[model samples]
Target chain A: MTIEFDAPSRDKLALEEGTSFTPKFDANGLITAVVTDADDNALLMVAHMNAEALMLTLDTGIAHYFSRSRGKIWKKGETSGNLQTVVDVLTDCDQDALLIKVRVAGHDATCHTGRRSCFYRSVRITDGVPRLISIDEHRHFVPSEVYKA
Target chain B: MTIEFDAPSRDKLALEEGTSFTPKFDANGLITAVVTDADDNALLMVAHMNAEALMLTLDTGIAHYFSRSRGKIWKKGETSGNLQTVVDVLTDCDQDALLIKVRVAGHDATCHTGRRSCFYRSVRITDGVPRLISIDEHRHFVPSEVYKA
Candidate 1:
């Protein structure tokens, strides 16, 4: 069965603090999902989820997202062998975004580049010129081997 | 002068490791900025930044965002006293999203609702029905007192 969300209401229960989860999807019918490792507060990936993706993630306790490029639901780590198991899911006050805490399986990586997290570089401006420097230069796997195989 | 990012290149400079910082903004001319407290890794706020906002944040070391609702650039805590001082800014491999490590001033609150972080509620399934449970119920400041002035 699919899950649907009601539009937020004016009722005190729904406005200040609601019993129901009313997600506010954007024009693309998607909401941002900020994922982090449960063991540590390290952020992993930022993705988009449709209502269906959100429902599936909640029901299956696995992370699923909508791939705007492929235009389909993506089960994160399905191709990378870095599946993420949902530990907990939190929503912000406006209910427009989601924060997912998960335990990463396999390589414990979340980036397609095989980095532990997608964030691996720092933007630096030295001598008035902007540049990027790799900070966490650790790769859990080789992307060519993971994606080409 | 305003800053511009080159499109990420296919050359070894970009694909393997590049010095140039090329940010790929979405069709909305915006990039996602994930904020966390510098003192602790506690996620503070997830916001969006246009080129102007991103430039301002980088130049000022203060959090600035593109307010979709107001259709203007927002210097966070402009109205409130909770200013954010960016300690570091990290970019993802794709250079599309940013992770901002910040030191929040004033009440150290990032949420308008008076929470240190905007994500304060966890969604749970009880009796086969979805409900919201307040996980971080601590309010650092009263919203009425903070905003009404």
Candidate 2:
């Protein structure tokens, strides 16, 4: 069912107070969004969610976010179809952020550019020079035909 | 060159104070990490960075994080090799968080599960029920085979 935004609820107020159960948000009015595996607490991904997006997430039980690039509301899997089914939404002690636990639908792939998570690359130092660790293969998810402009 | 995390020099402290930069750490002693674009202003991801991972990131210019599950430092590309190269490290106003801006190396793929980002799913309301919006194809990255074993 659609959950309405309760701007004055005890839960929301408690979050505003920075109580022990609130999530923390940054100065830009965005909360740190984290997704974890429910069974083992394995971190799935880290993202950002704004108030509108958070409200949408609460209402729809699907993840929604504000895209910095397009500067608009982004619905996950809109282009790809791999969706995150929300199991629960958690807030840290500060109430300005959230930890969203979800069960990934279809495949485990959540990234758009075609990795598991957005953080695929590793940084390494060699002889005082920093370089990217290389991987063996490259995969593409959406065919070039799909988003052909 | 090898950058040292020496105690902030007087000038450094002055600059830090002038900029109101403060680093935040979680209960696990990990800094609150924020990912931004190349300009270092557009926020991309909000995650955590432990001391070891932060040091490694600084030394190697690749993003490293403490995987709460694996209970060790995880280099971004250890498996898939889509790496985030460190461009700059920034602190927030309260000295309780950090902003890490990086240049994604290799492919545009950043997510682990083969999406452009880790936030590929969306929450939508269907028939008055919160439902996940699904996408069609899967591309790019491979699943974590080791985790299944």
Find the candidate with the highest TM-score and give its number: 1
Q: Model 2, range A1-149, lDDT digits (tens) per residue? A: 44433332356434422212222345566676766555554444566787778778777777887765577777776666667778876543224445677776654556554544444343344565433332212434643533455
Q: Give the TM-score of candidate 2.
A: 0.47
Native contacts kept, each candidate: 0.66, 0.04
C-alpha lDDT of all candidate models, in order: 0.84, 0.55
Who wins the lDDT comparison? 1
Question: Considering summed lDDT, which 10 consecutive residues are worst modelled in model 2 chain A?
Answer: A15-24
Candidate 2 regions exceeding 4 Å error are A1-24, A39-42, A134-140, A143-146, B4-149
> In order, what is each prediction's RMSD in angstroms?
2.1, 15.1
lDDT of 2 by residue, B62-117 (tens): 88988665788888766666678888664432234555667766554555445544
Model 1 lDDT per residue over B1-149, tens place: 45566776767447536768877788899998999887767888888999889888887788899988788999999777899998998887667788999998898899988988988888887655667888887888988898985
